[model samples]
Target: MSSAGGPAIGTITTEVPARLDRLPWSRWHWMIVVGLGTVWILDGLEVTVVGNIASRLSESGSGLPISDSQVTGLGAALYVAGACSGALVFGWLTDRFGRKKLFLITLAVYLASTAMTALSFSAWWFFLFRFLTGFGIGGEYAAINSAIDELIPSKYRGRVDLIINGSYWLGAMGGALLSVLALDTGIFPENIGWRLTFALGVVLGLVILLVRRHVPESPRWMFIHGQSDGANAIVEGAEKEIEEETGAPLPKAGRAITIEQRRSISFVEIGRTLFRAYPKRATLGFSLFIGQAFLYNAITFGFSSILVKFFGVSSGTTGYFFAVIAFGNFLGPLLLGRLFDTVGRKKMISGTYILSGLLLFVTAWLFDQGWLNATTMTVCWCVVLFFASAGASSAYLTVSEIFPMETRAMAIALFYALGTAAGGISGPLIFSGLTSSGVVSDAVVAFCIGAALMVAAGVVAVLFAVDAEGKSLEDIARPLSQRTKPTGRPAGPPSAPAV
Candidate 1:
């Protein structure tokens, strides 16, 4: 392994970013996707398992000494708090050290924390472990998003990011299915079944860690940090592999942007970039993130409760319904993701957000009219989330793409922390209260609120979203330290036929 070593402080210009962007897709890209994208699945699995087993955790025979409210309420709050804190701390570290390093460390943190969660006997212990688990997952978001955007070709960046982030729903579906088996009393003891759920996620994380070990550091980060030799080696290796796979010549390298290399970046500069230099983009990021966070956290946290309260559904059966909904969520990104590249980011982003919000509104009205049963309501939710899921995933894609390279991780961390703080904490509490009220009108009001926010976010997207589709990260926002300026040409036009 090359030491990702670079200068302490200096200036350098390199075409490493252009070289990486010009390469045709090959097995190497898929390897990057699988190794890095699995974190979201682990996150979705952990979250879904905990939500599905909240009832089991509260049972006297489940070994954990915790009430249902404690498990679902306080525990969830601690996890979100930890995630928010971790993003800030790790986001800065990712920018300072390197993407590959922090991503590996974060996954290790998640594997260790989640494995420990199965051994927790008391509520405090369980809460602590959950927080630690979230902390790791939060760090993964910052590190992985940066690395993926840097490595993936700009032309395919949108769809790749959407699909990768959307992989969260795949994990959700897996968790829902696993919960049905693991939570079944016939299969295992009450205490052991739920424990097995946490263990399942740990096993998956371990596999991902092994795969990630073969993944390399972001060469773009290396070049900017004054490690030209290391960056050139990586890009050359990738080009060779890709050419062998495609059996053709690679595209002409694009013009390189010159940049000043710095060993350290201050939080003050990151803040300046967001609020001072790119205020509208900053606003767009907040609106998208907060709206999606509120909608997702609310529904995901209260999904089973809604089924039980409104439709006389059982705890065990909720997983099946949620699984069906999770499938819809996954399909949204897989099917529609390509449009983000071809149709353009702003239009597609706005369309998904607004359309999903409208669907949710219609679904809310149907529920209020007493026209929905468990099956029909699940179907409606599936339709609504099919669009909302894509929109939500795009929010992460948006924040990750629109910022400068120096503060890219921190920018994502900033929006995620703020959005999660605003919506992630209060959303579940509000929805839980509404669902528990036994009044359809109360639940209807909650749904309407989420719908309205989604619509507003869509409007914001229309007004403020960056037209970043098929654009390089460097083209989208020049690095803070970039000394050379562009002269009306994109990092050179595509030099080879689109593969």
Candidate 2:
């Protein structure tokens, strides 16, 4: 061929940007976030508010009417029971059905259950409502996290999810505010505080419905599961809109990956894929899942109780203290986001693990020396929570990113289910058991253990985990990265998928 005016035989251009598979934060992102946030907030409230409410319930001779010890024991029991159910049920449903549909159904159950509990005539009713709410919460935790992980650009995935999840702190603060205000009025803490607080969940659920209406079924998932038409439509619509606004050529489409007709894959196949196809990622997911569960449950469930019992803070004061602590939680993820993208994934997460551990060690020392009494304790806890939020958020984001759309829900659920069920149950079980058995002074011990575990997990992650920040999802989830090792991993698609 002539060099100057002649046509080349094999010249090609990619119309799609590398970032297409990953979506930027837009109005769609916000709408879906609100949907996910509502579910997450309720989950946070359900776990955290129990400590404050247990005291209220016990004093009023309502629902179990147990002593402080009994309240802790039963609440822990109920929570674990529900969480176990969640890990099993919701994760399965999320993968088997559509994320968008399951989103609606789970919220309805949460709203109805919480509303019923608010008007309960006795403790039995309250207990039942809590169990049901717990169930809804369990399912939602798995679904929303998986959905958002698949919905966004791999590069921006961590920040999008972190911001979405950071709203959980806002939810906790709301609960704390309500707890303090009610207790101060001498109305809620006396007999009906827990009831009113739970009703707030119903309001949250209603709001979720409005927001979720805007969230489409996960496009990545649709493509993976043979919903090609649905997947193409979601991507094409977004592309047309982007082109109109930016005046750019349409995004490039990758080599065709036809959605084959076949019987639905079995759960065992998903499990085998996790364990065999990508064992290291599976292990990473497991460690992060369990470690975070330990960290979060310890803080959320045990903090209020320690405030009331050791510090002698009034219920209102405790609420304010908890709210301040959560403010740190809300900020932690945002701060981490800036570094998470620039620094490689391992560097950022490994740092979070070490820093979080050190912070908690300092937090424990402050609490032990009585240096953190009341106001100081709240301040100290906030600092600790900030670091903890960073580690926890990174863990969740990584888990979501490490798996593919075909098995992402199951992969996420497997770790989350095992870790959350164990850690969620363990936090309350340990605190209540120690309190009842006189084995320990307070809940601070849980933080100490959590920090140590995080350090260990961080070390493991750095040693084995691959850096995934800024990579494509298809590339990130490819088994050959490790399974077919020694042939250095390749970078980028010749053409990118229309995200």
Error of 1 at 395 (Å): 0.7
User: Model 1 misses residue 474 by how many Å?
Assistant: 0.7
What is the C-alpha lDDT profile of model 1 across 123-193, one tens digit per residue?
A: 88999999999899889999999999999999899999999999999999999889889888998999999
What alpha-carbon RMSD in Å does predicted model 1 have with respect to the real structure?
3.9
Computed on alpha carbons, the lDDT of every model, listed in order, comes to 0.87, 0.66
Clashing pairs in 2: 15-252, 16-251, 16-252, 22-153, 23-153, 63-123
Clashing pairs in 1: none
Residue 329 in candidate 2, Cα distance off native in Å: 0.7
Q: For residues 1-499, what per-residue lDDT tens digits would candidate 2 score against the true structure?
A: 1134422212122212233553444565566677676676776676657766656656644444556654565655576567568656877888777688777787887888788877876556666777787777767767788788766766677677776777778778777777776555455435555667777778877877887888888765554444545655776677666666666674444323222222245788787887887888877777776777777775566666676777776655677788788778989887877667777778877777777778777877766676767788778767777877877877767777787556666666677777776676676677665444433335557668877877777787787676877766666774211222112223223542222
Please tell me which predicted candidate would have the highest TM-score against the true structure.
1
Off by over 4 Å in 2: 1-19, 22-24, 61-64, 186-189, 245-263, 435-444, 479-499
